[model samples]
Target chain A: MSDANEAANEPIAVIRTPISLDYHYSAGQSASRFLRAIAQGKLLGQKCPVDGRVYFPSRGACPQHGVTFGDEVVELSDKGTVVTFSIVRVPSENIPLELPYITINVLLDGADTILIHVLDAKLEDVRMGMRVQAVWKPKEEWTTSTANILYFRPIDEPDASYDSYKEHI
Target chain B: MSPTLEKALTAPHKLEYTYKRSLGPVLSPFFTALRDRRILGVKRRDGRVMVPPKEYDPDTSESLDELVEVSDEGVVTSWSWVATPRRQQPLDRPFAYALVKLDGADTAFLHVVDAGDEGNMETGMRVKARWADETTGMITDFVFVPA
Candidate 1:
């Protein structure tokens, strides 16, 4: 063995290994209901009795109200305003989607929480407060997964005013 | 538990972590042998052997590099029966996770013992390495079975 100085430059054998772990997750109360609604081509939101704010992909409990609304589920509209968006151009092996895709965080009608999904439109056409609607997959392809909606696309309506979605941003 | 909540929809989900890691100098040799169906142990200053060898002595700070070959057959020092195996475990059925002392080794290594059921697992029971159909130099390359 050499001294610390010599050891610093010593050749070492390095072994590279790839590790993969798999798990089965239980989608608890709220998530289970939300997924079921997606499977049926509908959007469900849960309201907080204390704040009167509804959350899409219902959080089983309300953080602001500090209460649980097990029986206070509400249906939400598919259309939403894009609170924000980013244009992704860098290609990566890990990402499943195509390059140059637009990712947007949407605040659905009647819901307080934002839903993140890809925007099916050109980067030049997307802007803050842009109204987009969920384009669902064919009925045969419907399942209890967020994949039920292919992507959100621009609707025939005008862009929402910045003040309308400022709180969400 | 709330009684008013309706029955929610359920679906199967698979979770995975995609990554790679490098095993340093000491343990690298141990796993490399596993790829070739062999076992290596590290020798301590007192001459006792440690299987699944570590880079440093647990009792002393001395670096250990003496590699010693040990027989795969070993005795189970302790064990606990798992009735229901979790996902991604070595075996999909029942098995005992045991501390095994291999021949020529002083320390025990934690590994699974495939004894079919808890009734067949006992302290001092002799077991041997049952290699996987395909080896990849990982700790999961083999499990122990009754010798």
Candidate 2:
């Protein structure tokens, strides 16, 4: 390589280009019902006809049994136990949280599957089997999106026994 | 409720990212030349000049480093007309994406030609670089126009 041009001596420019794509997302049958229920401050789950296990925010079918769920909707408690969690230190443009925030896979009561959500608590305090409950935004601010549930916070109850949520992890 | 009768929920989503990248040794100088209204090509082992230069020779896999200045004016070797341009396209109106063999260059490079109408585009038409008002060392610094 020849050092011919004086422009080559200049510092390399770091280009910051923002690319954005806009599109409409359609929430089909089962998800429509789930989103509507959440807007009304309720958690709904569908029971798999074969296994009889309930799935929260159901996608209309059972992955394990390979069968579609019917009208058997189950109302669930917002309180859940953290089956697994991770502390995110890296910054992202979409996430409006501070550094070192905790994200958890929570196993809600009476549901077979887990719901992934943000956990607002001290990093050291976030652990497996930690008892937490959903903190929702005001009623007027409620929308058909999961963003209605701002985040989950720790409750005064004792941590659930490992055996209670062992299978989920 | 029947599945067909139920109105599905729809929401608008925007996926965005601001990618910060360093144009390495080869590309760094290429873009820098564009800022000064200059076009560059890399000299291959056979002395063939490739516009929009690559870091390595495509066929021989040799590391290409000789930067040669090429004329912005070129002849369109091949072209495909776009009836109605979509978002982020070089031209909002109708245009043609052409492989232009710039003067003094051996190979052709793909770029948009803002020819106003598709009928105005041809295989061997002459075109020149239409530089942007503010050049920030980016590929989008210029588009081609009928000269």
| Best-matching candidate per lDDT | 2
Worst 10 residues of 2 chain A by lDDT: A1-10
| Model 1 Cα lDDT, one tens digit per residue, B58-147 | 999899999899999999999999999987577899999999999999989999999998999999999999999976666887999999
lDDT of 1 by residue, A68-159 (tens): 87766799999999999989988765678888999999999888889999999987999998999999999999998988888999997988
Clashes in model 2: which pairs? none
Q: After superposition, how far is residue A167 of candidate 1 from its true place, in Å?
A: 2.4
The prediction achieving the highest DockQ against the true structure is: 2
Clashing pairs in 1: none
If you assessed candidate 1 against the hidden native complex, which CAPRI class would it receive? incorrect
DockQ of each: 0.21, 0.54
